[model samples]
Target chain A: SQQGEEDPQALSIQEGENATMNCSYKTSINNLQWYRQNSGRGLVHLILIRSNEREKHSGRLRVTLDTSKKSSSLLITASRAADTASYFCASGNKAAGNKLTFGGGTRVLVKP
Target chain B: GAGVSQSPSNKVTEKGKDVELRCDPISGHTALYWYRQSLGQGLEFLIYFQGNSAPDKSGLPSDRFSAERTGGSVSTLTIQRTQQEDSAVYLCASSLVASGSLNTGELFFGEGSRLTVL
Candidate 1:
């Protein structure tokens, strides 16, 4: 079974708008990492938030994790056309052998 | 020089034939993983290897699929008697550690090998 499930399968917004995607997981996770993938390309690691951390920021990206709700959200502020890609959230469980269980992913389209 | 690498970026083979995909993890990285992604779908975990520990093959779809990591660095995934349903992008990733304690378990992914089983 997949551990993570991302909401809003697809999203389209203007270049400067803010885009947010949510992910929910079933089991307790050691950490959650976000990645970006261009069409037909390998995933690029973006950010990782440990279970002990509540929020993390890098560049224009902000990720918030709420273990109480078993959910996490990735926020891309002032989105750019370059940010148009598929965003995935992978949850890592200690018992899962460090293998990341990826979500279905959220495809974001930034219209310039 | 610091990323995972996969071979045969694309492959096409007839059904019932066998295909092999290779992956080279980053230097000194002890953790490796394999995944399959069908069109418009999420990635499915296949297997995992961490150092000398026993591999975790619980995610393999069937007995037809198997993977091996040599010297704790390079790995290969093999599928026998392939079916059309097996046609998908096979991805490989490696991490610095098997536990999330260090490195946050961020995996370095390879450009997946797209397999087309006709």
Candidate 2:
């Protein structure tokens, strides 16, 4: 079964604008990781935030995790056309042997 | 291979035919995983292999789907009597660790094999 759901199933914005996608999961997670896919190709690992971590940033990407609310959010600042892709959040806990359970994903479109 | 490599970047076969997809994970990686993604849909976990043993095969959709990893290296996923619904991109990924913590929460993924069952 899928573990999480990304909100705003789809998002569209002009270049240079910011894009934010939210994800919510059910069970407690030891860590959460984000991924990006372009043109139905292989997924690229983006950033990971552990349960104890509240927020993490890599490049223009910022991920915030709130274990109390069982949710996380991905914020992309200075969106570019190249940033258009599907974003997914995967949850991994020790009980699951680090096997990830992924979410529905949020599709973002950056129009130039 | 420097990264996970999957064979037959694309495949098309008749409905009743069986298809085999191969995945060669990065050298020395202890974990390998397979996932299926329908058009515009989320990834559906198919199977996971740690070393040569699959502690979790629960994600496989049906009896038609089966996979095996040999010598802790290459893995193959076979689908028998392929159905149109089986058409999707099959992705293979690998990580350095089997369980516990990941130094870098990263999984190297192959370009994936696009399978179309006509």
Candidate 3:
């Protein structure tokens, strides 16, 4: 598993259900961020959780980071069909010149 | 444009040919970056630019790949002797500031330019 790599590459859930995705990294990070991409489009920023923070939320989305475990997770509550897209996690580490490295991403399919 | 704009949305070229992709970042944004995504692959960082000068290009795959930003606004990514392996969606993003304590995680991205090398 590479740094900023997410598991459950593909997921399917019925509308109104909650969905969760996981990401793990090898190195210490200054912050972790989530992103969403519609088909054939550029990514859109979703949320950011700093190393010092354990959990953060934005509307229907929630993000948690555990530095001790070198992992992070993204949760989407009350998922709708519009939530179908690819989700990626990115790691930002100061030791690495503060550039972001993106993960492979999870392909989410929210069925109506 | 109200958002980041990219030119030549799609380009198809023969192998060994040179190609240029352009990106116009949002107005008043001072930081820009270039990234590429191969099919089924994650976004790969190509370079980072602050103002008109690039400070980090270690992610560029080879010498054949080069990028330059001018006037602190528009940027051009040039690929020399393009190869089939270079086929990908080239994406450009901009932020209000460079990566640091004050940096926000949000990045405004342009619809990527899809490049196909035959």
lDDT of 3 at A38: 94
TM-score of 1: 0.97
Give me candidate 2's TM-score against the actual structure. Answer: 0.96
Ranking by DockQ: 1, 2, 3
Top candidate, metric TM-score: 1
- The best candidate by DockQ is 1
Score each candidate by Cα lDDT: 0.92, 0.90, 0.89
| Per-residue accuracy of model 2 over B1-118 as CA lDDT, tens digit each | 8889998999999999999999999999988999999999998988888875645898999999999998888999999999999999999999887533645547889999999999
lDDT per residue as tens, model 2, A78-106: 99999999999988776877788789899
- Kindly report which residue stretches of model 1 are placed more than 4 angstroms away from their true locations once superposed: none
Report how far residue A101 has shifted in candidate 1, in Å. Answer: 0.8
Per-residue lDDT of B1-118 in model 3, one digit per residue for the tens?
6889998899999999999999999999887889999987888889988765546898899999998888888989999999999999999988786653435656788999999999
Instruction: By TM-score, rank the candidates, best first.
Output: 1, 2, 3
What fraction of the reference interface contacts is present in each model, in order?
0.61, 0.50, 0.41
lDDT of 2: 0.90
By the DockQ metric, which is better: model 1 or model 2?
A: 1
Q: 1 or 2: which has the higher lDDT?
A: 1
